[model samples]
Target: MKIFLTLLTSLFLFFSCSTDDDICTDGEGTPQVKIKFKTFATGKPRTLDSVFVAVDYGAGPVAVVQNTVATDSLMLPLRVEDVPFTDIYVATSSTGNLSQIRLNYTTTSEYVSPACGIRRLYTGLSATLQAPNPVLAVETAQNEIVNESKTHLFLLF
Candidate 1:
């Protein structure tokens, strides 16, 4: 009976404790902002011509896309760290015709895991077109960055 009790206690202690190395770290980072493009005339999904994306409002213009071939959807990381808002620059042509979009959101710190630590969760998103461009309209598909499958914005071109 004494040996059985000692083994049971040891098992309980081992199972109840958690270490950073033992924590699951897969898919622990913040979700990226997703955008889908559509045509204004046809109202159907369409791809743009080598759209260039970057963070042009902060510190400097950090290039996110450098002449990306062609795509109807884009998945971009905001700041990676904790930030209240993000400014995204989208350029369609090589002539530097840029369209600036400002995304404002509220952030909350969340505990992911011991290995991943805390991550920022963005919510209550609001977007504003800072510059005039080919984008005719903007739509918000989802406000929070809870999942990467959710489309945060829809651009009509």
Candidate 2:
């Protein structure tokens, strides 16, 4: 009867309405740069006993990695602002010597999805090592950061 039709319509309407849980699960977003440490003499991968990293995203130095144990590679997030460069300080230990590294690049925004929005892709990537001690030199690997699957920079020690 009329009551059955009204209940059916109500159920259909409730089921058809989408909720906020319909989110983007495509894993499409800003990618972090990956850096690997290597031996300066043999040019082989080297593992650090302990590592400390601080990055200046514009405001001040912020500790991103603190006392990481036995890590050969590092994943670093860059600045997404209007700046053209990011400064990072790396140390082998908590009180070890700090080496300053400046990463210079140009960014381009790409539209990923509606939920993910736009992501910044860095190009013309270059690095400068200002201090020499635990970290000696810098080598560019990929030069462009489109994804996080490959090594972007090599820190020679």
Candidate 3:
């Protein structure tokens, strides 16, 4: 009787400790949008000496990249909160020319794991280029950003 009680208690403890927390370690989250730079005249890939990217608000602007040198490609993060729309501003220099790009997408809750709960996944991606645009054109290579390898936009300047 003593041996049976001990075994039962051990099994119960093992099962109780093994919860969803152990299985949710591989939870995936939203990925950043990739942008590739190109020459407006040549239509080929080019590198910028420095570029600034940020989100602007009525009061001020939040900087994503400030005076950072980017070669060929850059990964820009999108807003993952409850908001469905994100507006990003990009500049070639610190006090040089700038442009604004608006990204509109739909968000859906995805079940990652019980421990991780849910994460927001964006789809139906679209972009709008605003005035004072320094870019020659914008091309969307990938509309859905599921991984880091995905290139969302190509900017020609």
Candidate 4:
């Protein structure tokens, strides 16, 4: 009878000590802003041979996209702090001729899960092309950035 009770207690303790609820598996997190490139004349998609992107979150500037191959879409992460805008720099080449673009938006935090913590969401999105050289114009596609599935902005070249 004592052995049976000990086995039962051990089984109960092992089953009750499970920590599966602490693991976040839904992939709920901050979403990145998606930008697609298009030609200014034809209004069609344009593939860049070499593209470089840098953004300033809090510190100076940090490179986000440095690709040598041709690509038409880019994913950029916004600022998570209390700043209302994010400054981005795009360059067709790595040497010079960097165009500045500022992304303005309002951020809100939502609780995802215990393990995932809070995630930031942006709304009222707008873009201003401060320098127009390689990038001719900026177009806002989506006003809110809730997920990475949709294009938020379009860069006309």
Candidate 5:
């Protein structure tokens, strides 16, 4: 035997040219894609095992888009199967990814000096805040404003 006919012709050409779960080509079949998950902030509607979707693809062979019901800001319904041509890089799993929700804040500015003689008159304030999840907007100068000897500096986001 020629090594058993060269191992049965290389296992019949590697099982007739590789493919599992049905694929007759010239017959057309496997092609399903439906990715839906949106809830970055109250767009309302999300559910994919708790909306932490992440797909730069490469996790294919999945199938279950809307298996019944699961969308209330928990977004998740990804079933991108065998791909004839699909390019997806979905997101929404950044509970703390984008630099922990991106935040850059700065503070420490006060120039209140309009008396120009006794050197005891001040009234200048500047505070800045950047966002991804930053919600700090405060302006205080009430009650004729003494600012209580001014000694409060907090930069939080």
Candidate 6:
């Protein structure tokens, strides 16, 4: 009886003191986002007309004017920093899913961004956007960690 009790206590102690491995640890690194666009996004795939690429910048779209290089083959411009994408509306220009533009000009349409501001001039929605909660006052930054059924990650921008 004494031996059995001793063994039971030893097992309980060992199990209780066991350490757990962190399975959901995402190593410390820069938080980055990839902008995925659709094929219909590239206006006039083979033309020299400017195609605006706007970034909402978490608030709304910011105009980044850039023109497409009329390539002999399937070639895409490196970036759009000059075309005037801000507030401009393209029926269906930029894509949510990234893909190469297929010409026939069926998908090519006017570029317009849904930004509300002064007429004849539209601004990106991001400009007037507001963070849900800037900071929890004094709390400044909030980071919650969980190793159970649910895990929440709050990364700083």
Score residue 121 of candidate 1 by CA lDDT.
78
lDDT of each: 0.80, 0.90, 0.76, 0.91, 0.29, 0.25
For candidate 6, which ten residues in a row score worst on lDDT? 99-108
Model 1 ranges off by over 4 Å: 1-25, 80-82
Model 2 residue 15 CA deviation (Å) reads 8.1
Model 6 has an lDDT value of 0.25
When superposed on Cα atoms, how far off is each prediction in RMSD? 4.5, 3.0, 3.5, 2.7, 26.1, 21.0
How does each model score on TM-score?
0.79, 0.86, 0.76, 0.87, 0.16, 0.18
lDDT of 3 by residue, 1-157 (tens): 9999999999998988756666555426566788888887888888888888887533356987885655677887777776777887888878877788877888777777657777777788888788446776777777777667667888888
Ten contiguous residues minimizing lDDT sum, candidate 1: 20-29
Q: Judging by TM-score against the true structure, name the best candidate.
A: 4
Whichever of 3 and 4 has more TM-score, that candidate is: 4
lDDT of 6 by residue, 75-101 (tens): 111112233322221212333221121
lDDT by residue (29-82, candidate 5, tens digit) is 211222233344453334544323232234542322223334432222212233
Ranking by TM-score: 4, 2, 1, 3, 6, 5
Better-scoring candidate (TM-score), 2 or 6: 2
Q: Candidate 1 — which pairs collide?
A: none
Pairs clashing in candidate 4?
A: none
State the displacement of the C-alpha of residue 74, model 2, in Å, after optimal TM-score superposition. 0.9
Residue pairs with backbone atoms closer than 3 Å in model 2 (clashes): none
Number of clashing pairs per prediction, in order? 0, 0, 0, 0, 10, 21
lDDT tens digits by residue: candidate 4, 1-157: 9999999999998887645456666447899999999999999989999899999988989999899999989998899998999999999999868889999999999998767788999999999999998899999999999988899999999
Query: Which regions of candidate 4 deviate over 4 angstroms?
Result: 1-27
The superposed Cα distance between candidate 2 and the true structure at residue 113, in angstroms, equals: 1.1
| lDDT at position 57, candidate 4 | 86
